[model samples]
Target: MKLQKVLSALVTVLMVALLVVATSASTSAQEPKQNDGEDQTNLDTQLYLIVATNQSVADEKLPAALDSVVKQLRATLPFKNYRLAATLLNRVKNEGRLDLSWIGAPIISAQSEVSPLTPSFSSFKIRVVKLAKNTAGETVVQMAGFNFGARFPIQTMSVASANAVPVINYENTGLQTDISIREGEPVIVGTLNVGPSGDAIILVVSAKRTSR
Candidate 1:
């Protein structure tokens, strides 16, 4: 009976020691577990879709935050105007996958009074996402199999024929590539030429930790 009690006490002490070690490891901020459970870290990402067009327009100021991006675009791309298309936010755990499908909403045509425009489809997907700190002390988000695709209506031609309507065709375009973005900094993923027109779509993305 005495031997059994000694063994039990020793086991209890070992278990306590192990638990203390675990507690210390978890609470050590220097050894961060960014890929841990949702309760431990924030893995939400925000993406901005901007349309770059050759068509000039008034009030063409993009968000001041994207000023650097715009300057770079102007130096490289031939687009004369930029417009904000959409802003999307999605949450993903580390090394997890996410896909979001878009349902295009129908809107009445400004040119044609007879029918509403056809609905288009758009989607974004990522096969795997990871988060880590870079050598520059910035949190970096790395995404693999990043894909953005869409189909939209485009007017083929305008005619003055009596009792005739303009021809519209659906065009499919997208961009697929891997991307790495630093926290709070917008990174341009890629661009897709929208249609026969000189317009293009630019995809900008950023990520942040909502640990607060």
Candidate 2:
């Protein structure tokens, strides 16, 4: 009888061990994946902020990178000249968020300007950035809540006296929208009017997939 009882206990222990192993295996299978391609694709995006104006400056020459765009702008825009004001670059992973702010944009200074110009404050953001293949099997970047904003300084009044400080004011320009563009292609997100002069600011965005 003792032997029979011992055999039954052994069988129960074996069943318990099997149940534990099965539970562990099921849990492991249900866990989330790591470093999956769906979430690992990454890219670097370049942002160019160009100022278009009718005012002629000493340096009318723009960046060589924007040669094609300059021609297009000259054809479409009423402004006779264009100059690069700022360029921002950032890298983000698929399904990621990018947010940045700075006080680094060049102040609006035309030719023969004597007073100092205030530094421009700017911000850029993308709430959700993703990399995906399109219908043509080409990779594109999709962005939600893409936004750009800036506060540009303008000289309200020149100093009347040596003891008097220059009166200044600020003008705002920017846009916000969702966008999707193919990799390595530069896109103009939006155009905005800035400062007292009839100058316009054009935003260009270029993206390249750097990793998968």
Candidate 3:
């Protein structure tokens, strides 16, 4: 009888050991999966910036206006990428997922303080003129901006007769032989046929200087 009782106790202990081992194995398997899930969640939480601008401006006006600012951040900051979206002010305010943004004037003034980053611009200029203003009264064929760093000019041409010119005005020559104006470092020359309004131009220069 004593031997039988001993055998029963041994059996119980073995069963308990087996149960403990099974539970430990299950826990170990579940832990790795749970850890992986958490790692993925962290990756999803990684920050990305969303840049938004107003749609009221013609689409053509936007790329140049904002690209300089975006490029600054891309050069300096640590972010995956920036995405441009045209969204209403209220919609932007309500989104919990917006990590960073480059918004228009209205949104910038309103929500910039609360955002993770503040938007700023690089020195740039925009000139618009009628195509008839060029020397020799020829139709303005292209607009040029001189980037001093590159020591070359960025020239763009428009078809609707109205040329949008952005010049990097290093020389400060005003409305010379070429129908162009000075930005900061590069001079912008305008071309094309739309200059009848006598060359209405807008120049936007920023306070920040890019490092060499």
Per-residue lDDT for 1-212 in model 3, tens only? 99999999999999999999999999888875544433111101111113322322322233444466556644654443333323212111111222222322211122322332322322222122111235556333222332211011111343453674333221111222322322122221221111212211222222111122
Q: In candidate 3, which residue ranges exceed 4 Å CA deviation? A: 31-59, 63-212
Ten-residue segment with the worst summed lDDT in candidate 3? Answer: 40-49
Between which residue pairs do clashes occur in model 2? none
Per-residue alpha-carbon lDDT of model 1 for 123-150, expressed as tens digits?
A: 9998888887778887788888999888
Provide TM-scores for the models: 0.70, 0.75, 0.21
Who is ahead in lDDT, 2 or 3? 2
Clashes of each: 0, 0, 18
List candidate 1 segments past 4 Å from native.
1-39, 105-116, 135-138, 158-161
Local error of candidate 1 at residue 50 (angstroms): 1.0
Q: After superposition, how far is residue 1 of candidate 3 from its true place, in Å?
A: 2.8
lDDT of 2 by residue, 29-120 (tens): 99987855455668898899888888866446776767777787878889877878778889998789999998863445554553335677
lDDT (CA) per prediction = 0.76, 0.81, 0.30
Better of 1 and 3 by TM-score: 1
